[model samples]
Target chain A: MEIKLSAPITKEKLAALKAGDRVLLTGTVYTARDQAHKRICEALTRGEDAPFELEGAIIYYVGPSPAPPGRPIGSAGPTTSYRMDPYAPALLDLGQAAMIGKGPRNEEVKKAIVRNGAVYFAAIGGAAALISKSVKSAEVIAYDDLGAEAVRRLEVEDMPLIVAIDSRGCDLYERD
Target chain B: MRELDVKEITEAIAGLSKETNVSLSEDVKSRICMMRMKETDEGAKSILETIEKNIKIAGEEDIPLCQDTGLACVFLDIGQDVHLVGGSLKDAVNEGVRRGYTEGYLRKSVVTDPIRRGNTGDNTPARIIYDIVPGDKVTITFAPKGFGSENMSRIAMLPPAAGEEGVKDFIVDAVRQAGGNPCPPVVVGVGIGSTFDGAALMAKKALLLPLDEHHEDPYYAAMEDELLERINKLGVGPQGFGGDTTAIGLRINTAPTHIAGMPVAVNINCHVARHKSVTL
Candidate 1:
């Protein structure tokens, strides 16, 4: 059945999502993808403090479109999730609670979610425009020179997403 | 001599690009409807419902259907009789792509270099292919080919005796292997012809067919039917979430092969198939 969602969701709420639950979310979320991810991973490698606090934050796996005249964001949707697999284990260790994207994550990412009290949310893959409308405000947070791939802070309202993987490692995708 | 200026071509290209990116093609729309009716797995059917709703919201809101927007791929068939007047056809198309990608606020996915991996600022220099056809007309088709579907496309050359059954095995196996990665209930495009590259092109071109339309050749149509049945049986299902409709549609385009060998290629497209054509 269709259900609305909110950000900063607890592990219990996230674990509630089965395959068919439709969700609409709200609250603060951060954008990350290939460029931003690489930067974050590199920062971790260098023992340098990264741009944003990783403690209990939502990291959206997206690189959004440029905002038009008066809107807050352009077509904003989830990118493929697997590309972030290598870096996710690190973030989970840092206490990031939620992830948003499409496709499946690797086994390590899933296990980390369980270990760190985190979850993965799935925004509709191609429904960028619809998803962007939920963003009330947005601003660049780091990696300014990386262009669209830079990390950004977004204050969203009723941003819709469903749980893809929960803390218990119950995946919503195929295994074999 | 008329100059084929960037102004009109740019507008048309931008418009075509926007229309294609936001809305599902008519053929795709109708085929999904058919699938919704025929799908056996409840979970897959529910996913299909969300997809249908997503399309509706996209059109009504005039938002992009998917955020990826895809790498710009332009196919041009210019007739021998007409000459471009003002701007070069390539520039006009590129300019159109730039305008379409920018104004629409679509993502700039085209990278400038393969190894270095630099973004091209604007999604320019579309992957262009031109064919000289008879008469004085120009037709342009844009397949905003998304990465999820593209990464899974494959090509192979088989012995002539491997024949149709071999083709079926490869197609089904590819889907089974791809699992949930390429997005499910995929549109499978099969191209059978000479050489490896030709097979690939044939497969990509096969994606141009109307979803519900079938090949005129009964033998080929039967193969398409058999392939579809086998694919569904593989149980890859919708979104690989487990269902009956592993594939939403299948189209095959064949060409005469060399006497010595037969080549085959299969290109898998996710359910979000976005493509369109314009005649100028």
Candidate 2:
């Protein structure tokens, strides 16, 4: 079913999402890929604060190209999600509500999603050019030296996605 | 012998590097369209449509097709009867990459060091493979390989006794393990019968082949058809939403092998499948 979801979603709303539901997400989301994920987890392990508020946050796994003239971003799309598996459960434990990426998450991530009422959304992989049109604005938030891997705050409009895994621990990847 | 200037090579590569990222060739577009027609699943069909839209948008707006513009891989086939002058071929290629990436607004995805992990900032130092041919012409094939699929690629050295079944199994398994990670409806290149590294190179090179073409030998041609069918049946679908189009194309390139070893490499490429060539 087609659903429109705004970011900073509540646990109640997250729980209502099911695997294979089409989502058009709008509002502010954070971009973090492999390097950024490692750093975020490391900071949490060091008992330091996350770069942004974790509660009700939607983190997108992406490393986009540099923005060209007259564009807010370039080729923004989801990267593979498995690389973030190690760090995802902790963020979910801390109240991060959803993750945007392509590919299946590990068992631990799935369990954590159910435990914390989170969802994993799959953006079309390699569909960057089309995806970029949804980004209304983007600003680098932290880890500047990481270049494309830097964390960014992006305002997206009607960003299309599919619920690859849901709060109830069902997965679209594992077809029966 | 024909005298060729490396400066000319640089200019050609620079254009090719940007051109490849901005637009996909007709062969790839047609294959995707064909798959879209064949796809039955609602979610998968929509994803295919989105891909088609993405391609059109990229071409129209001069935007890159994907965010991971990738590590520049340059294949130079220089004819034996040509003498290169004016500069180092390596430097020329790197310069071309630098200019192309910077000018085209393509992502600089390369790192200066694997361990230290510093962005090169210009996407230079292309992974260049050189070959010498009989004619007095130089052909450059440029493919920017994204790590998303590159990471899923594998090289396995099997016992010669593993035979055809084992090789087929390995290729299929690689795609299975890759699953949605490499971006399904992937293009798979299988390299068999060569030495370890050669097999890997061949597998990567095989991706440059036109998707609609088969190997000249009927034996391997049939194998290509079989492997393509098997991979698509994985149901990984477009973006792993579950459908019959797990892979769009599969190519196999082989070489003479050692007596006791059968090295196989599977190089998986995302649906973008960006590759272009220039003859200088």
Candidate 3:
């Protein structure tokens, strides 16, 4: 079944999700990858405010190509999730409700998902051109020096995703 | 001896770089279409269809097929009889990469210092693999390699006694371990029987081989056929969703190695498997 969801997804709504469910996510989502994740965790460790609002946010693991003429963004697709695994639990602890990336999360990340009622969604890997069509608008909000790795707030419309792991810690990857 | 201007090389590189990123090559596109037609799993089939759509959209809009346009891997096969003129070859190549990426709006994915981590801004300083051949022309092959699969590549120095079975096992296991991360329906490049570093280089070079072609030697060709079958049976599928098309193709490149040690390297590439060549 196709599940259409908007941003600031609540735990109550996320609880109903399970592995292998198709998701059409819309509204606002933040972009963060390896460097952004590291910086966010370091800021949190230093007790400084996160660069963006963490609670109820869905973070996408991507670093898009530069926008061409007449487009909001360039080919934007999910990077591997495992690279962001180390910092994922920390973000989940702060009530980050979902992550859109490709591949399986580490065990700690899965455990944290169960603990915090977060979900892990896999956007199609390497399908950037088609995926970019879903992004309506984008603006870099923090760490602009990181270039492609900068944190961006994106307004999306019907971004296709799959529930790779759910709040209950059931993983689509684990299915035989 | 024939003299060639480096400016021609620069112009060729710039155009080829943009062209390869925006358009999916015919061989790879056909392979994906063939796999999609034969795939059974609904999710896998749907994913393949999405990939087909992405290819078309990218070509039509002149957009990159993937976000990671990748660190430019430029291979130059220069003929020994040709005298390179006008400017330093390296500078010309980097300048070409700079113009191509900046003009094409491809992502500058390179960092000057691996540890310090800073974007070079224009994807300059390409990973140029230069070779000298017998003729008087330069052949440039540009393969923008994405790290989603690069990170999964492995190099193993096995005892010569371990032999062919050991190599096969290692390559298959590497793909299995990689799972969904490298993006399945991958093109696997294997380099065997060289020095440690050479093996790894060969593995990456193997990626440049056209998917429609096979190794010249029938022995290695059969090995390629068997290994591809074994990998597909792992059921990694398209995007690892579970199906019969885990790997679309596998290529093996080999060189002479020391009697005591046999080196093997596996370089996996996403379905994009992009490369474009120009002879100047």
The candidate that achieves the highest DockQ relative to the unseen native structure: 3
Q: Model 1: runs farther than 4 Å from truth? A: A1-5, A10-23, B1-8
Q: lDDT values of the candidates?
A: 0.80, 0.92, 0.93
Q: What is the TM-score of chain B alone in each candidate?
A: 0.95, 0.99, 0.99
- What class would a CAPRI assessor give candidate 2's docking? high
By summed lDDT, the worst window of 10 consecutive residues in model 1 chain A runs over A13-22
Sorted into a CAPRI-style docking class, model 3 comes out as: high
lDDT for B261 (candidate 1)? 79
| Model 1: per-residue Cα lDDT over B3-76, one tens digit each | 34446666778888888888988888888888888888886787777678878877887777777788887888
Model 3 CA RMSD to the hidden true structure, in angstroms: 0.8
The native-contact fractions of the candidates, in order shown, are 0.48, 0.88, 0.83
Clashing pairs in 3: none
Candidate 1 scores a chain A TM-score of 0.91
Off by over 4 Å in 2: none
Candidate 3's TM-score reads 0.99
Which is the leading candidate under lDDT? 3
Worst ten in a row by lDDT for model 1 chain B: B1-10
Compute the DockQ of candidate 3.
0.89
Rank candidates by lDDT, best first: 3, 2, 1
TM-score for each candidate, following the candidate numbering: 0.91, 0.98, 0.99
